[model samples]
Target: MSMVRAPWRGVKTPGVLRRAPAMVAFCAGLAVLLAGCATAAPSGAGQVADQGFVSGDGSVRTWDPGDRDGPVRVTGTAFDGQEIDTDDWDAEVLVLNTWYAACPPCRAEAPDLAAVAEQLEPDGVRFLGINTEDEAPTAQAFERTFTVPYPSIGDRSGRVVAELNGVVPLQAVPTTVVVDKDGMVAARVIGQIERSTLESLVEDVLAEEEPTGDGS
Candidate 1:
């Protein structure tokens, strides 16, 4: 896996190393092996035995309704051989996560994600996963192991990641994108998300009023 250094231009993480060079080094070290030239970035270098857990820097980027870009177009096959697309998520808040079975941070945060999904789904929030490096069977096993309530798209073909391109710049595994009901990306957590952090972001999105038809 190869790593590229670049300044992440969004919200900033306070206290921790926030300089571009430091962030670049952070991205370089955590790159994961995947098919083609794709490399998944971990949240950081922190790790435990068998669990590459990296605590997130707690950087949250929230965009105003008018500042949101166009809805991201994503389509792929789920691990269960079901076709999935972002278009089907119309009029609902959706959470998109990038992860793989072997990613330590991904493993560590699986339960938190599942817990939040359960709490938010009834409120019209949806959760989707993008398994960056796993095949259907492996990805399915990971979900079962974690008891993840959401279905993940197996991105072995790399098409899904390619599609994400400018939409999210997918710099790290365990990155979370929270889209509002109108399909606008309302917020993003660029690393492993805590339950409280994710929950608070979703609540903020839910509280946003729908776009007014009148030019505001």
Candidate 2:
């Protein structure tokens, strides 16, 4: 239940965004035409709503092996219509990234994340996005533009974010969380994730020995 919290990060994403200007433009146009995308409401007391968005300081946090909490028991349906339950996944590591279509940091990290996910898939690492905002078309457009290889759960009800907030401070727009084989939150990047950082975090968890059934 204890972790080392370090925050503040930035990444280069102009290049990635440039790769699909038309897709970004299309999503942006949709956002404008739709009035505005639904912003995520905090399911608790402290809600950071500045300019309709609040981004984490891109800091990273890590919990020690013995200090990690029990597994996260969250279930949600992805935009692709696939049912996802953390408890049911059999991967050695899971990466949960919180994002929406218009969030700058989210957009910035998308390509890097997709690449890292693909690179780490053979290591039995899985990637899933938890989007608390955005409709199906907007979310899917970004996915297609970025060539995102994984599914993103539609957390429009904020249920999934609330479930995650119980385990960590999720008061920001783009946060990347790394879960170990035990399904416990092992590490988190509070803002846009750098490709190397994500790789290292997942790799660190992947390197750990499997947990014994009796809690080691």
Candidate 3:
């Protein structure tokens, strides 16, 4: 019997396969470098997102009336176990903030947020808090410490964040989103929001004309 030579004896390893890991690592590094160099665009009559936070820059942004998205749908149980939903805020200005007591920025901006809530109450504006990483007791304690006038929804399940997908990215611990009277997303302040800046955003939303019968 004649022995047949192996057909695959002369095959060589491809260069790409040999260098695959290094090439993949180089591509990942390049992606990070490009992201770091990217500049954020300004929106809504010069509202700009400045330097982001240390965890990540939560850039601020505002949308024009025509560019605003439809009302966000959100609902959850408050830290005190009370039911809360965005339906109650229809046709009214609303502010929603994501926070956790342990976050420094969240702690730093609590007082300001509380103050803003107090100041805007008379204007019929409503505020809601989303505690993304805290239990009821911790959230309640933080509310007590900051004298918060609004009820915060316990978002440990991430339900609220999921509902706010298109409206707010919720990337930062202390992100704030302002909804116009029409229930549309009017503005967002990423990271720790300042008292004056938040106030201005609310005022801008409140100043917008009420939606006509067509929901303009």
Candidate 4:
């Protein structure tokens, strides 16, 4: 008697066919992972990483904010006398400019920063000042003198200044960091930026915002 056996019992299909679903899934998952990675940089946003800074024959220092695992925690009073946590301020682009009332460069840049804050308000950017080397009274005076509309976070201990540079030594005043919506540092400018330059940089940052019909 001939035993009836399944015709395809032991025969294997082509490797590609056998693993088609897995391969497809792997490819799909890979695409998703890559997409997530690519989205790290917001579209139309200009990111100036540590590499962008001039090292000046390695004498000029640099820091990788990417290496920073989390947001730099800070607590201070706003110019309006309201307490603020650095994490609580929500905006697409965060401009953190370290200043002191006494520094000439800081004085020079205050108005530019104020203008930037005004121009970017409609575009969902938050411009904040960090008074790293000044007391509250001094900062208040500076704010009043410059007519700074945005809040200034008093960095009495200079920790925020140190953290922003990823532990790199900050030798200059008036350092500015442009942070993306994800709270990652996008660009760092170390010096007084002219009004035109400040405006241009702010425009570049605002350009990254995805337009919404509601002007909220």
Worst 10 residues of 1 by lDDT: 1-10
Instruction: For candidate 4, write residues 1-216 as lDDT tens digits.
Output: 101111223333223224657556544543332222111122332333243321111111223435422233445667568776656766777777666786655676678788778977877788777765566788889888988988887665444543443422234456666666655455556555556665665566556666766877
For residues 80-168, write the lDDT of model 1, one tens digit per residue: 87777766764368888888888766777789999999988878888889887877788999999989997788765444554453455
* TM-score (all chains, Cα) for each model: 0.71, 0.72, 0.70, 0.60
**How would the candidate models be sorted by lDDT, starting from the highest?**
2, 3, 1, 4
Clashes found in each candidate (C-alpha, N, C closer than 3 A): 1, 3, 2, 0
Give model 3's TM-score versus the native structure.
Answer: 0.70
**Over 4 Å off, model 1:** 1-58, 210-216
**Which candidate should be chosen as best, given TM-score against the real structure?**
2
**What is each predicted model's overall lDDT from 0 to 1?**
0.67, 0.69, 0.67, 0.55
RMSD of model 1 against the true structure: 9.4
Window of ten residues with lowest summed lDDT in model 4: 53-62
In candidate 1, which residue pairs get closer than 3 Å at backbone N, Cα or C atoms, i.e. clash? 52-104
Screening candidate 2 with a backbone cut-off below 3 angstroms (N, C-alpha, C), the clashing residue pairs are 7-59, 8-57, 8-59
| Residue 21 error, candidate 3, Å | 26
TM-score winner between candidates 3 and 4: 3
Local error of candidate 2 at residue 146 (angstroms): 0.3
| 135-166: candidate 2 lDDT, tens digit per residue | 88999999999999998877664545544654
